[model samples]
Target: MENNIASTDNDQRVRGYCAYDWGKSAFETSVTTAIFPAWFAYLFMEANGISMKVLGSEWTADAMFSAAVMIGALFVAICAPSLGVIADRRMIKMWWLRVLTILGSVSCILLALSPYLGVSVGWIWAMIMFMAANVGLNGAGVFYNALLPHMGDESEMDAISNKAFASGYLGGGLLLLVHLLMVTFIVDESGSVQSWVIPFAMASSGIWWLGFAQMTFKMVPEPHIENEMEPMGLIASTKMALGEVKKTLMGIKEFRTLFIYMIAYFCFIDGINSVTALSGVFGIVVLGLTVSGLIATILIIQFVAAPAAIGFTKLAEKWGTKKALQFSLVCWCFVIVGALSFAPLELENHDEYDIQYTWDEGNNTYVATAREGVNNIAALPDDGEQQWALEYEDILPVAENEDYDGGYAVKWAYEKDGTPTQVAVSLNATSLAALEGTMDESRFSYSISGGEFANSTGLGVEHPTSLGDGKLDFIPKTARSLVWEPLGLSVFFQFLLLGVFGGALLGGSQGLARSMFGQMVPETRSAEFFGFFGFFGKVAALLGPLIYSLMTVWFDSRVGIFAISLLIVAGAIILRNVDVEDGIAVAKAEDERNRASA
Candidate 1:
């Protein structure tokens, strides 16, 4: 029975990693990337608009989202280290994961109710829920990541970590696709889904939580030496944690590099995140794309890129992590450039003829064709008239009750075509130069058809017109004709190459770090130090969003994102410099020095 129990425990530990991957995937995709942001924006748009004191008092939905992320980051930074310490103290680690996972998952389920809440209350609730969920997700991730050193041999760490990341990408992508299908195809006309959607999502998360909770309870053994020897009180514990954190900071040799790298990561990642948040919004507002179009586009990106992200690992192994990461950064640069190429201002105001009025019996209204003609008239929305009779009531005379109908009543023609059309006549330089009455085809092309006019003639307009610019413009001309615009085949190819190669390098390095930890730290301090690792990594969380947010606001979202690429670039540079064998040697020397001093 003891052997069986041990066997089960071993199995649970392995499965725990898988559960962690699944849970994080679900949490991030359902709550973070896919549904929540979109829904938040929808609510914000409905509640008048998203207003921030930051962005010139104007409404920017992206700013609000960024603000929420920053607030969440702050919360994570404060609690993560303390929680990490607390988890190591007793068998409470499983309990923390269980409780917090529930908290996070439940909050996510509540998000489905957002559409029903109406804008004001709903938006606030969403912000709160999102913040709460992120905290839980990050907190749980800290513990889960720490479990890595315990799960595998030192050498397998890279492959394991990379595999875990790949799993997360796949799992999250799958769930997102499912959710999108329901929203897109199954929802009713009122834009509401069958009540089952929320319940199913809630159930999925609950199942995920429950399955993982069991794994944690079974696999991660209680710390061998739980500080049962007069554990500090809660208040005292906080102080103890704070003191230890200070010591950890002061004692670590490469602390400067770690902190600087974290800062750089924070700065550049923020830029990337900001652009991501704003991309769909920019498309909607600036490009006149429908909401459906934007959603479809994002979905397309995920579907196309998930395999690419996974494949990137292989490329990383072949090329090296640093090169791959640098390449991904470059791809991001082009994505930004392509996105901003057609700023909203560049879109010329073209004609969309929506008929606002109709005419009736015997009215002589001056409807222009070339400059003034009858065929140019667009029928009113409700009008079914084949030949609209010009009524006296429809005509607005210059003088009230003045008889233009009595004098040489202006003879006019009414077209009989059932379909409405518009003939746009602009008095621009080209038209002016052509002479008032001379018929000349301008750069914009249009075909005019009307039967019954005294002179029924065809007008040839220009096929395309040049707008306010020289060939050599300040803004780089996008490869507009290409389907992906800035993200052409080459950029995509580069993204694949870099993402694969870099992912492998980072994955391998992270694996190696965990392996070294296993060899160096005693089993008792392993979890605690892993907690410290969380603190170290998450320090970037607060600043990452801040940098991204500020850069986006400062230099437009694209340039801001370009700035973020510097993080991966910098991380690669610093990571390469972190001589692993040397690090181990130094660490051993420091440990001996401490022992001698004692």
Candidate 2:
């Protein structure tokens, strides 16, 4: 009867631990991947146009987002190990986890206030809150992971770890689905999204994180510490923590394989983390996908990853964890290459329209002939409009009763000094009809200046030959045309397909990695060692974004993405040196020694 009670309690605790993953995943999916990036991009665009000048450098919204992640990761990397040591000595892992969880959840809630803070400071506030939330998330991860070794025996580690990841995917996916529906259906009279929708979604992620975490708090007891020291003052505790960290570093040779595996884990996980952190922004900036498309793709990844994580456990059982991880890393390499090569070209002509444009060099204004037969050519001023305009381009005569094939679509590609830039938008029949009765020639324009423009129909529309002093003024002509166009696929569909394959590997790799580490970590020193694990992960987190950000600023986003693949390949190479059985032997010996000492 007593054994049965104990088993029930153990199962409940495991469920609670998994529930925390479920709760916090809402924040990961809704705020980090799905809604928040899009919301922040919208706000940034509204406040500062397409790009912003920061510290004398031009930064796109995606660049700024990556920079924020880098900063947050750096802070967490510096603090995680010491905090881990302290929690180990004091039996305060659960308490520390709670504090960090609260911090993360509160920061998530405060993110709702960003838009209300006024356009001038809203983006900055959002960045600050996002960084704080990241710190909290990373900090909490150390303690959360520290609890893993105590949850189950080494034999059960893989299943438990993967279960947690699977639960996270389900939790995050469900919340994301709800948020997607909210955004899709809730719109104002102008068909513009309601202002409160995104903010509320952000707030709900926080609520979900905090609310579900209570299960973990209530069910998972603090791990008992043997021969624990009496609690000391904060400063003294910090000093002791530092001393322990130094001792661990100096004695690292005792656990050679573990440290080596950590280094290998650092490299490959950097690539994986970079992809997850930057994929949403990448979709928006490079693929020119709609926000809805990005969200839907992320939703697909979340659901797909859940099952994949479980499937990976079986793979690990069959092929061993190291081999399974290597396979996933290989898939990741292919994904990155696929992203670099993804260029889609799909433009079908509905009808052709003759448009005449005249450049006024004095005012840098481009005027187009609005009405051809009427001789009433309406001249439109450029006036900083980042869209293509036909002004009063006249349509050819048609039979009064003849069926028009949805009026004419004037497909114009804007060029600055003969280089195509930005996504192309067309002035369709509906837009032309709206501008027909209006004297406002500006109404004839539609935004065609943000993504990779493909078709140049030679409509004779005179666009600005220069973008003044903008940093993106010199985009390589080759980058626009050379990659994915010949594949006969759209970038949006490419992203969807990539997500499908990538998602399959995502959860499995992460789950198996954690389980492998858990199997090799000394149970007695789980918190202390997992702190080192968190340290390596957080530091890797910092380096990945910093490298990608620098590469993006110095070269371009494609180069940055290509750079990430090298990290994975290098990590996989180094991982080949690790012997899992030998590491497990060392861990068992250490655990037995510690218990004997106690």
Candidate 3:
């Protein structure tokens, strides 16, 4: 961002504050939502097919991701208030922000090592680093958000906040664009993704975060406190925080409306947060979206969300923030139903499947890339133990056949049956056509004969969500038959459509959720009330992902999606009964009493 985020902006300090949002949002959009999910899926698929057996259960990538998100948010949610109290007491908000930023950015950079640590350990390493990085992100946010109130006077703070939000959107969007171009352009000769591209992108995002944050550290001075307490140790601070929480709990009857609103806020916010966090992984693992497609979806969300956020402000002005927020939450329910309705268009083209052989018309040749797992036959060495390997002879016709015109020749070179040293296969255009005609797909592509995920390998394979739905995948099934197939759109296009609609709802709901609460809270208790606001928001962040993860483990991913939708519906119902005017009156009365006593 420019030193002044805008030429019209006169305040250098405001630019500094906005700069921090610009820097850190790279982590939010690029590493968390865009790249890591697809990258981890690729690693996990190589290490453990579909799901890894752990604790007598299958752990899929999406579940692991949600668990990581839950753990990260849980840590921050529990400790953030105490940490905020400590920062305010010591007047060292900037100092703590700098430290946590390093922790997060460095952890992001460390993710690049996942590949080089060996294939077997790569996925696990990523999970560990991802958890650590998230801890830094959410933890640092404790102090980051604390600094916002100090950015400008009450009159200017809201506009300053809006500008920072815009900066984050633009910064994150640009970073995602860079990453998208890297993955799209950097490829092996055969057009497969190069291993180093993702690693380089990961490291670069970390650098972007830490590098641009220097401007903020310099320009945004530590907030001045009127009666700053001496910094205390962790135990002392925790005790003080607990005492404050007790007082808040004691005030329930006095601020009944606010507490009720908070509960509704918790349920709905958690659902929306989890959906945003896990959408990328779900697209990759279940829908089989390419790396390019997932990034594109996030990029679409990034740009679309900015304008939508502003548009919601207009809506709030017209309908009132409370009603506008309720409307947005209602739209969220529809979004969830729409998400469950996403089924891949039945694959018809030769180029659609993951491991496929397709004729290249431009080159007049056949091209193929093989997969490792197939019907227990295509297994490789594991833990120095020999395993069955799929032999080329099984796929190619016998050369001694009478009709064999010698247009195709196949040879497998190896030191051991379990490991192949080399494979050489050549076929002319006519011979390849003949082989394609003779080849039975069942022989080439296999299935897991028995298990929960007994998926057949082929172009027209249904999405995992559809498989989970079994005979009752009625919504998505009807959807594909009626809408997707009729329009002749690919799954990527369908994913984009979801992104556009969902992104708008997401942006509006999130932007309005806080603004509506702000309007109802008293100015005198801004710090205390907003602290609880942040607490509910952060704690709720973990809840949705945790529920999604658990439901995914117990049932299926689509079941997880269904479970979260119910949460939004619950929150919206609760929200309808909240009296916004009564809450505002209570807040005003409380502030007046405190001022008179002082």
Candidate 4:
């Protein structure tokens, strides 16, 4: 059965294509989502403390990372359509796919080298390679998706597309499990997970991707063209591709249904991506979820999404791909509603403070509880090290890395047993004046560990009395009082339920959306149209995040989520008008016309 494994009807070729998804998802789930962000942040902080000024604008590690992603997406958007034109005409989609895979995998391997380069250069190297990897991932996707129309007919497209996504989730989840173990168990004598473990993880992800991708290259054959264009000089070929793209643009009316469907695709997909991107940030920043907890939640989503994707294929078989997709979009709307209502329960005891430094009077100790605003928590993956106390003056203390806004030396110190605590926080005039202004009696309260300091000198660190509150605290508080407490669901349980349900919907909708598009595409022109699809996809990637960023800055994170949800609602409305049957008919007719002419 392996003989001529590239046959249109061969299940082996289908396996090969699915294997590619299985392979590449190692990068998506593990490297991009789990490891790279943390690794990059560490390197960036080591090189530039907290943030750096570039062109009078402050850039944090996260901002720089987002910029890199956007840059890669822009590159793919500019080139995808034109390249698709060239690939279709030249019958070289497989060739381009292979080339981009190498580029991406190699870039991943290059990421392993960043730690060796000193901190000064490592972050820059990581950023460049990260962008390069994204370019390869996005670029290869255009060709890979184009193969879907050729993979099977309209009847099978839903199963094939969803199966591939299912394979991706399974493969990614497995690899991420391996990585999670490696990170958790691989520790040194000092109890720190060795720096090399992360680097090894980065390299292993690339190797896994590159190694399994061979199954695709070995078994899948390049699609043959009846009127294949011969290779010409790069300039001439590019010119020809541009002309072909222009002709397709001019004939947009011929594919009016397909175009309409694409418009709907653009909005819903943007909303889905934006929500996925923001959910983690919301969990960490607003809900007090730790990094380990976030990783565990992502793993849960991955496993839950896999079977859910396959289930959607069955649903598509029963209700038609378009209808199935519409159902998923509506479900997504419900998910957004649930997310908006999520609220953390009010804090108890020391949890009431974002960063608390206090005097334990009975114990005669200085206590510090570093929560939301602190960094570099020195503990194992899942340890309750949020609060610690100093019995007397000790060298080891949780020092603040970020100075006050006006730039001053502020060091919190605990003294000998009799004295208990000593506070010499050097403050500039500006910070001192601001602190003095806001130093309301009800706003801050504290007791010196030993009466000697407070009773004698009356000197200590500034501690806000009513703490752990934000500008948007009222939103979660109101929701908790009205919705959560009544339902008797804690925020953690609420988040878990939201993630599992939303992830299932996300998997189903993503697979069904792409599958529906594949059904509408003319077999002869799949690559060309898929190029346009990729262009829109890349642009959507940039646009959705940008919209979330703008809305978050203007209002709150919840408001940003609300804005994105509206995009899905508008898309679902537009989708109702798209005629899937007419689009498929147009595609069949176009393919027939191409065959007859050839």
**Candidate number with greatest TM-score:** 4
Regions of model 4 farther than 4 Å from truth: 1-9, 53-57, 350-368, 371-479, 486-488
Clashes of each: 29, 7, 0, 2
Better of 1 and 3 by lDDT: 3
How many backbone overlaps does candidate 3 show? 0
Q: Estimate each model's TM-score.
A: 0.63, 0.76, 0.73, 0.84
User: For model 1, how does the per-residue alpha-carbon lDDT over 1-598 read when each residue is reduced to its tens digit?
Assistant: 9999866765566665665665557766655665666557756655644343544575456667777776765676667666665555555566666676767667766665665676568777777777777777766666666566556543344445555655555666567677767766666554566656654664465355445456555556654433333566889888877776667668665444434433443433444544555555544433344455554554555444444544555555665444444455555555555444442222121221111122222343223322122122222222222122122212211112122322213222223332232223322334333432322422212222232222222222211112223222224233333333444432223233323433333323333333434334333334455565555555555554456568756754444444555554554455444334454454455445544543
Q: Using TM-score, rank the candidates from best to worst.
A: 4, 2, 3, 1
Instruction: Say what the RMSD of model 1 is.
Output: 11.4
Residue pairs with colliding backbones in model 3 are: none
Better of 3 and 4 by lDDT: 4
lDDT scores in order: 0.48, 0.74, 0.69, 0.77
Candidate 3, overall lDDT? 0.69
The parts of candidate 3 lying over 4 Å away from their true place are 1-14, 37-69, 87-90, 109-130, 149-162, 187-196, 218-224, 285-288, 347-472, 520-531, 549-557, 581-598
Q: Identify the superior model by TM-score, candidate 1 or candidate 2.
A: 2
* True lDDT of residue 409, candidate 1: 31
- Which residue ranges in model 1 land beyond 4 Å of their true spot? 1-12, 41-65, 89-91, 112-123, 190-230, 254-478, 481-555, 584-598
RMSD of 3: 9.0
lDDT of 4 by residue, 393-498 (tens): 1312334425333221232322322122333332233533443343342222222223333321111122311222434445566778888778877667878887
lDDT tens string, model 2, 226-327? 887798998998899889889889998999999999999999999998888778666665554556677778888999999999998888888888899889
Between candidates 1 and 3, the one scoring higher on TM-score is 3
